[model samples]
Target: MITVFAEAGYEVDRHFDDGVVMLGFDIDPTRRSQAVMEAREHRAEARSMAELLTPSSVAVIGASREWGTVGHALLEHLIDGGFTGTVYAVNPEAFELHGIISHASLTEVPEQVDLAVIAVPHEQVDAVVDDCARAGVRGLLVATAGYADDGGDGLARQRALVHKARAHGMRVVGPASLGLVNTDPAVRLNASMAPGLPERGALSLFSQSAGLGVLLYASARRRAGSACPR
Candidate 1:
């Protein structure tokens, strides 16, 4: 099957199995180099779309105000980082978790969510992913552990969870990631283990750990602050 986009041009890549054929696109330019560049651009665009439309976001599937809990710090990090979007915390057992409106399930969020950060139990990860998919969430950042990292059935479960996410057209970032931060809105949405927020400027840093990201931000902030000596 061939699908042509108005501005992007035609599909040139394909995969076939049984009676199903997958389609790809060709970048126009009539040159190999330009074609590759265009193809890369298309791939990037697809990625950016996935990230941007991640719908509503939450810190933990069962967050609370308890110390050392995902619930207590999730909202705090968002507020500290200045996340100005729709943020919710999911904890069915609790009426309100950490002063934020809590929902028993992602379905109760009342709005379409493109992404969710699941800190639920390992066993609950799959069900949570299923719920997110059913709720139309396209991106998932799972911070749960107890998977293959231990080297056993845990690994198998983790792999299976990833496959389940893929089947649902959802992108999973990590099974053991610290989380992420968005500098555009001056927000840090990752785990509290992060260092600290960076100074405001044209540059942004993407780090693997909240601590590291914050550290980098601090460095940048210091540098920026120092550059303008009053």
Candidate 2:
């Protein structure tokens, strides 16, 4: 006689004719199976991140009209960088910015937002994240600071923000990041807060320090001289 029990392709227990019973010997297979699942999950997440990086549409939350501000600079960069995708500026106080209509909130936007760039204060990060989750945003780029790097309660806040974003199946880029940029002609997304746009090139850069990255980008632009050879 033989008895077997399985779950989702995993064998839980087995019994054979010689009165032999396998108790928890399935641990190895279970671990291996879990590892496989996790690998697949990581692959899926990588694909999702790629899509997010090249979204067809983006919404900049906490956009502002005031010059020199992070929110304003991000919006300006996106526009000046020649991003072909739809761009939405969200600000409750302003109806328009840089000639584009500004929605009062993410929920108020009529179309779906592929990625949401948040520039609000750290204190308001939670609420904005909640709004983005409710709006079904696929990716988040948080430009606000005052978390983790600030230490103490700030670290907890950053952890909570990540947890909430994960719970809603959304990916977060940063709590105090300089944001990202893509040089693809079809999707020219310059979401960073750099002083100037870097010339388009094949080289993609990732920097650990925001200040250093901006300086490097500026230097590259100077060397490239207005246009980067394709």
Backbone N/Cα/C clashes per model: 18, 0
In candidate 1, what are the lDDT values of residues 73-92, reduced to their tens digit? 65567555556566777888
Judged by TM-score, which candidate is best? Answer: 2
Residue 26 in model 2: lDDT: 50
Candidate 1: list runs displaced more than 4 Å.
Answer: 1-38, 49-59, 186-192, 201-230
Indicate the TM-score of model 2: 0.79
Give me the runs in candidate 2 sitting further than 4 Å from their true place.
1-42, 215-230
Would you estimate the TM-scores of all the predictions? 0.69, 0.79
List model 2 lDDT by residue over 1-230, tens digit each: 22232432355555465786645435455765676678879999779868777988889998999998889988999888888899999999999998899999999998999999999999788999999989989899999998888989889998999999999999888888898888777888888786445667766666767778767776667778454322
lDDT of each: 0.64, 0.82
- Error at 41, model 1, angstroms: 7.1
lDDT of 1: 0.64
Best by lDDT: 2
Model 1 lDDT, residue 56, Cα? 44
